[model samples]
Target: MTESTIITDNFLLSNKKAVLLYHEYAKHLPVIDFHNHLSPLQIAEDKKFDNLTDIWLKGDHYKWRAMRALGVDERFITGQASDEEKFKAWAEVVPATLRNPLFHWTHMELKNPFGINSYLNKDSADRIYLQANERLAQDEFSARSLLKNFKVEMLSTTDDPCDDLTHHQQLIKEGYEIKVKPSFRPDKVFMIGEPVTFKAYLKVLGQKAGVEITTIASLLEALKNRVDFFALQQCSISDHGLSTLPTHFTLSLAQEQEFKTFLKSDQAVFSDPDAFAGFILTELCKMYHERNWVQQFHVGAIRNNNPRMLHKLGPDTGFDSIGDYKHAENLTAFLSHLNLTDQLAQTVVYNLNPADNEVIATMLGNFADGRIKGKMQFGSGWWFLDQKDGIEKQLNALSNMGVVSTFIGMLTDSRSFLSYSRHEYFRRIMCNLFGSEMEAGLLPDDEKWVGEMIQNICYYNAKNYFGLNRG
Candidate 1:
């Protein structure tokens, strides 16, 4: 009815049943963001922003990509421009991003935290900026405060194998109310594509794990040590970023020895890189299962396309795109490899390419070992596929292929503090999908049962599945 209520009570719920289901059951649930790339240091430090630009535009490649598409200058997009200039640049691009998810996400972030109700454009930008900045300057608008406003009961920020998790420890020392835990992300460790970096990464891992990795077996031991260390910090999950699953292969000891020597050399080891990645990943997963940690695989992202920008700006500055890699056979083989030894942990599979939605949806069932409820989950739409269409497609595929009732749903997978509003957006969509089905008589007209399903998908499922305060 008004700017204050633009994304109000009935934002995405198209029918009476959906609205009733949402406000009654789903809207009040706390968020369980089990997978994300949020900075643990920011949460630990509880940093406050000086202006809208620092929190909104800086380090947000989603905005960077949109601004680039609108022909904004590199100086404003990612260069030495002032915060005011960068905000102005983003303001200019917001109007042009009419149908993009950026448009909705921009508004939700604004409305939820800053209470700003104006559409962002050249005309409204300065007013919105000053008002939002005024709110951010308050004591209640700090990073942790923002998360508190969104009711984030628990979150897991991504971390490297070599990290000491000092910030996670700090959160515990301060007794922060919301649970901020680490998810073990060892992409760099499994990444042997950059042979030079692989050797360098191994040295760092050795120092952290207190073991010199001179052989394949020794490397596995080093990683297992880190997993043990991470477990001590209450880490309950592991995430991998892969272009596709490695082709199932294991090297002989003589070949493994040769590969270990090759890691010490300056030359790239193209000699069965798949086997190398597969070996390291399989071994790590065994440790993961032993620790009873959930494993997540984010597959089908083709990252760092522009070497020119990559050199100047570095990775995750929006040079990435969806990869077209075939995932079915290799993915099956990879999961099967872990399962054959009874070592497959609770896994959530995320696909960036929508074409693989059904392929992944069905593949999840093959590894259901009856060890845990929803032991194998088709993860929420990730990265490039986190929009409304992509989100719906993932829900549809999972509902058709698996038991959607037990499905753990909706993670930001984002680096922004303001991104928690995404859970609200996702809950709205989930309600609308279920609501539409009920309105059409596809699902039973039981409000209590269906409403609880909405709650479980929004919060309880992830909270219970991840074993956070589950009593």
Candidate 2:
């Protein structure tokens, strides 16, 4: 249970001010992870892992990608290899991930939940695995217990429009203390090009909403129905994943008639997918505004890059990469269109490409309109950019171009329960960034002012922005 030399109390806190800021302001704050991909079923059932690998490695594309880079066999990475073998393989690759965020995250997770601060490697893998597995057998290591242990006050899970939400309902019935709300994610609703998949999704969505979606009008009605359903379930957020915002948002009468025909004829194809998406998404945003909801866009991911592996493993299994889509023009148009209509909801835009950091940061200013605090947010470092360097770049970009003080901070955006350590990792890096500035006289020597900002970024801003503290 003793701390390892590597993961001491002062792990990432380098300067004296950094150490002071971390321990005093950031360390004990309750985490409000506004977005993630955790399983509602697991939390509702209070699922416990049989071993460390079951909890740590399953559905973790980040580790899977790294294992592939190190030439580990697919059998060990994601194939039919036993859990023990997978753990051994991951342990062997740990030392090689020295500079990668995986190294820090791996240790931080182990240190906190398992209280095993030892550095993981091939030699220590077996012993550490046994220790972690033993702990997993205890009640405190169950899925719900883990969230409580991580000091997670609230977290939102990405869910589709047609999701039954039985698990979410179960949590509510049981009165789980942690707020686990579902964020409406209807990305599939925009897939007009893939007629077969889109058609099937529409049927399900229509059935759930109690409306038959035959035309564009009915489609909007069905979506609104689902939005109302989500609101009743205590959902106040919506998320969309796109390469970039669509510019061709207006649908002419001819195009609208064409959409109805496309719905009926299987062979019919929509010529302009962007136009279709834009039209639908614009209407959806209006509905969100009506509900007083927060909308989040996670843009710029080029997914399923490796078609061979994608076919073998299906989507979201370590084949996605940061996309270089141009954002400024279309993003501006999309937001402005909403703003002109007075339908712009509180939006947080997360870009996968590091090059788009300043683009998103500055875009936030164009739409802030003085109505809501941080109405347009440049979201936290996302996907590939959630690491230390990316976090620093995002913070610097916001500090330079936007109001960093009003910024709602980090989100796990992760599937694994153990990924809560990422918030800790982000807090330490943020404290160090500000702490170092204080020591160098770049910022004022007043701890109270800076510490309050740190606390806001760590917890308060997100709490207020999302209205998590409200009934």
TM values, all candidates: 0.97, 0.98
Instruction: Name the lDDT value of residue 15 in candidate 2.
Output: 97
- Residues 360-422, candidate 1: write the lDDT tens digits: 999889888776889999999888888899999999999998899999999988888899888
Q: Candidate 1's C-alpha lDDT?
A: 0.88
Error of 2 at 419 (Å): 0.6
Model 2: how far residue 9 lies from native, Å: 0.8
Task: List, residue by residue over 1-471, the lDDT tens digit for candidate 2.
Answer: 223637789888889999988999999999998899999999999999899989999999999999999999999988999999999999999999989989899999999899997889898899999999999999999999999999999999999999989999988888989999999999999988889999999999999999999999999999999999989888999999998999978899998898888888876579889999999999999999999999999999999999999889999999999888999999999999999989999999998999999988998799998878988999999999999999999999999999999999999999999999999999999999999999999999988899999999999999999997685
Q: Which residue pairs clash within candidate 1?
A: none
Residue 242, model 2, lDDT: 95
- Give the top-scoring candidate (TM-score): 2
RMSD of each: 1.6, 1.5
